[model samples]
Target: MRPPPLRRLLAALSAALATGLAVPALRPSPAATVQVLAAARDLPSGTILGPRDVRPLALPPDAVPAGALRENAVGRTLAGPMRRGEPLTDARLLTGGLLRGYGAGTVATPIRIADAGVARLLRPGDRIDVLATPSPGAPFSRTVVSSAPVVAVPRLRSDQGALIVLATDRTQAAALAAAGSSLSVTISGAPAGPPQNDGPR
Candidate 1:
């Protein structure tokens, strides 16, 4: 004995309740997270990672970097620079094949930066343009290497000078060697580091 409108209302409410219950089953679950090691500080290439250099992080599965492992990464050298908090991945670690893809004439060369301040600031993977004055007090102003990648920035020694590794051709290496003590450099954000001197390659 229900009216047509009343019967329709009852049917509509039943459908609404069914939809609300069904939606929970259809809802997507939260993605799982993985524990991985993340850099604790800005790490330059060639740096030997230490216990304090990294920390564990819980990251979403998809956000985890490839080759990332939760195991201790201490003592491993880096082949590339990493920003603080960046995930430490296998590919970024030092490997023999790192230089396999370089263009012809590329060679690893080490030079000493005259300025300790600049040398301290240089990190591996940094790009530096080499300039030489040719003569001191005259304007250290000749281009030796243009936009060369810093392969390594070795830890500075108290007595031993700071050494910066560069990727360049043999000829350019010779040029840098000759510029020794007269070379200067420029970097982004800071007055460029002093030019490198001829040091062991």
Candidate 2:
């Protein structure tokens, strides 16, 4: 019969080798990644997305941004500029902000405001009214837009003035655009009435 101490030594060695072999199997694997939409090239602000403009990318799980869904993307206009290979997030595309309730037939018209300070105070979802002045000091000033939803307040350089976007009807959009730089903005509280969203798109 084998000696008790010798048998114990062999059993210990057996367990040590078994544990060593099992270590590799117990080691966790790397986290799985996913394919997400990203800009193919340097996409400028206001660029309408096309199939060629964007492509799916394989990225690490941690790198995927919130709201970067392929189904939500595609065929949307960019509100802000994006560099090449930039991931497409919800904020990167134009639909959220003031376009919240009104879904269709709304035109995003970028208008320059007379007061940069007031424009800076304006945030998305705030309702505003726009006044137009015909000439520098003319008395022909009139209210061109009343209670309009403020969409995006774009980032501006130090030398640049404040520019904001509003969603309005086709005729209202045309009139606001045709008014030129005369648009002065005033931040009203919540809209006076429920959105006059035209029937059925």
Top candidate when judged by lDDT against the true structure: 2
For all candidates, the clash counts are 4, 0
Model 2, 123-149: lDDT tens digits are 877888777776656665676777788
TM-score of each: 0.42, 0.53
> Each candidate's root-mean-square deviation in Å?
13.3, 9.0
* Model 1: lDDT to the true structure: 0.70
Model 1 stretches with alpha carbons more than 4 Å out: 1-100, 134-137, 188-201
- Residue 166, model 2: Cα distance from true site in angstroms: 1.7
Model 1 scores worst on lDDT over the 10 consecutive residues at 192-201
- The local lDDT score (0 to 100) that residue 140 gets in candidate 2 is 58
Task: Candidate 1: count the clashes.
Answer: 4
